[model samples]
Target chain A: FATMAPSSSPVHLLFRQLFEKESSTYTYLLADLAHPDKPAVLVDPVDQTVDRDLNLVKQLGLKLIYAMNTHVHADHITGTGLIKKQMPNVRSLISRASCAKADIFVDPGEKIHVGNLLLEVRPTPGHTAGCVTYVTGEGEGQPYPRMAFTGDALLIRGCGRTDFQGGDAHELYKSVHTQIFSLPRETLLYPAHDYKGQTVTTVGEEILHNPRLSKDEESFNTIMENLGLAYPKMFDVAVPANMVCGIQDSHA
Target chain B: FATMAPSSSPVHLLFRQLFEKESSTYTYLLADLAHPDKPAVLVDPVDQTVDRDLNLVKQLGLKLIYAMNTHVHADHITGTGLIKKQMPNVRSLISRASCAKADIFVDPGEKIHVGNLLLEVRPTPGHTAGCVTYVTGEGEGQPYPRMAFTGDALLIRGCGRTDFQGGDAHELYKSVHTQIFSLPRETLLYPAHDYKGQTVTTVGEEILHNPRLSKDEESFNTIMENLGLAYPKMFDVAVPANMVCGIQDSHA
Candidate 1:
């Protein structure tokens, strides 16, 4: 027997697809094609994973409205420029405090509207100088953010190392304690990359149990001291790649 | 105000050096060369680290007697062949079960002499098909094996993933259960690679609490299944490099 089911109400879908590049870095595409305009946001997008994102957008009849980077990643190459090149109308947004060059320099408290979705830029500058988490919700006077794109600033069971450019453990401590951890406990924490196989977590969960960040000052100092040795494999390649918006010249 | 006179048993000389290549691998050399005939073993020796090994051997007036692989590595390239080329008198030994070719296939049951030092080979093939652990002591019948050079089988707090060639979880269980775990609790475990900032650990510590291996069969299976998603970046470059005993032609 064949079965057919119909929904009573239209689903306001908001979901993400993970794309792992190199071994450790993860990029994501968050789409909401329920609206006729079908605007989508690309977060921490990788250079090699652009085709998959493009194909998915075309298949779902979604318009790529925004391409954003949570931070200048040191693990894998970014694809912000490539997407902008392909979708000329799409806006390339990055934290204004970040040293990276982009089309739209978003301030910390500024809000951006993409179709029916609203994103508030929140600066989280521990992992990199201009790291930011994109808070997503429906635009309203009392909007409650349901999801946060936490780049490399925070992870599932751990946090990003603070040994690279503008990486300050003490600053990271402040970023987590005052900025991220202050958010709603149930807000889903979607990091750009997670090597432990965990796709998502919550800010409250991280505050209570993150092995690296949930520690006393002395213990945090010890962890940070030891963390000096954990260097990324793609630092040399990814830094240069992210600088030009993930552009690969003929030599590359 | 003068410092207490030093003991007559020499200065207990200790020398340490590191080899950094491709920004991913760190090859180390440690030796007590107070004695002219001091015998030394290369740890996690890479093909490019050969020149430093040769320099140390010459400067110390010591004989290069053993070249070792922690395991058939899947990350950085190996240096077994290059060392053999430079020091033909030195013996190239690894676990007989390792699929890679070696000049002298070592059986775990046998003990070999290197000047006044004794080295025992232990089969521990969890990371790859033919991995081995080299235990060092003063003599063949030494009461305790002091140092263990674990190739890729085990790390400080974590165990290698069993998803690559000859990487069977059952075999890893057997290898860890019988071969490595059976050693004295204090026996120092020195791994081939450590990205977590730890340089060494003890077998007793690992067997009792290694997050990856010290678990039930179901948990072990779950971890291994999850690890299958992210394969090593150097697997393609490393297999061919190791097959030819770590040699890399310019084209390669």
Candidate 2:
């Protein structure tokens, strides 16, 4: 029942999934572990945990070049602004479709590089007009099992509520099928929020088990429309703050 | 600033970290992805989350062979009994020193094999008399960055309280240094619980930043002794329940 792996490669990519409790948000710290310079990026960081994230960055001696957001969040403030203040060289990133201010606005098919790692930026809107999922892999060649940072576009056994902020059930459904489901079956999916404390999921599992996404288009739309979830408590405050990279208008 | 990873290995080991929010306990699910059988194991499962854990196991198409514990916990009950009740083939495992009822009594140097992945159990007592740390890697030659599942012997930037259940500060300190800290610098550490939302740490980071553990022996003991922590809310019920694999006298 036990055997040694015949072939293995040295781990060159550093991936750490950090959580923010107040918002149940996941902030990813990705770095090039093989490179001495240790270039890194933080995806979808929350405002409250900025200190912890930065401390981790410093402890690891990483040069964080980007604090990126998958989209404008309606749940909690982004840590991008706070991070930028502490580490001025760290640029803010967001999707161009987001209509939000950021240091760099990316579009579909753009490639984000952190040292030896590659994050293929693919547009996966519908939960919001601006949401994008970041997939890891060198686009054309090398069929490594990739990981997708699917913000709110897709969740574990569920999808995001498409009731507000330019929400559309049809768009969300189409986006997941075309962009996310098209990835390799073994691709690991990491979402921004998980209220149930689950950390990661695979594309294969989601296609088979995701309750909402697995349904027919009509049934999926019906399920989305009838979720009856209440208005998000932080929607008003978080959306405006996140618009300017999580710095409130008064402060900005 | 970006370069393709020179070499890479196909991922054959499946690792997922699940959480139970009530007590901040972490349950890990590990499997062999390269094997056709997909043999798997669950480490430190919680009682209330058994349904979710089993559901995940089913969804992943994994053959759960073992439900193991690092030690008998004082915070929350274990899901071993319930899981046994559901999956008759799955055996319950615990350290022999725990003096707890389990189908398999593992020792300090025992290797628990789940398909191709191997968990080399190493004694890491101090948080409790039976605490153990499971390190993953072939025992020799393979210099791969391993992972240590260090129950409460270590937490992110902190160590567990050594006040009860045969807890000892000195023993805990020596165990962490000799067993966990001795691993490769990049070896990732996953604890049984985390009060903060932090998920993983590395030996290098913990060595430099762990508050209590980074200190000399005397300072460490002083910090642990004067934590002034209140009695655990679920200690009385949980400890006894866990002594019999989380099934109470009435249930048994």
- In terms of TM-score, the best-performing candidate is 2
- Candidate 2 local lDDT, A8-101, one digit each (tens): 2222677889888888999999987655678899999998899988998998889999999999999999999889888889999999999999
Of candidate 2 chain B, the 10-residue stretch with the lowest lDDT total is: B1-10
Off by over 4 Å in 1: A1-11, A138-145, A247-252, B1-252
Docking class of 1: incorrect
Ten contiguous residues with the weakest lDDT in model 1 chain B: B6-15
Give me the candidate number with maximum DockQ. Answer: 2
lDDT of 1 at A146: 72
Model 1 over residues B36-109: C-alpha lDDT tens digits?
A: 45767666677656675576457545666667666667777777777776777876666677656666677766
TM-score of each: 0.47, 0.93
What are the per-residue Cα lDDT tens digits for candidate 2 across B161-195?
89999899999999999999988888989999998
Scored by lDDT, model 2 comes in at 0.87
- The 10-residue segment of model 1 chain A with minimum total lDDT is A1-10
C-alpha RMSD between model 1 and the true structure = 18.4
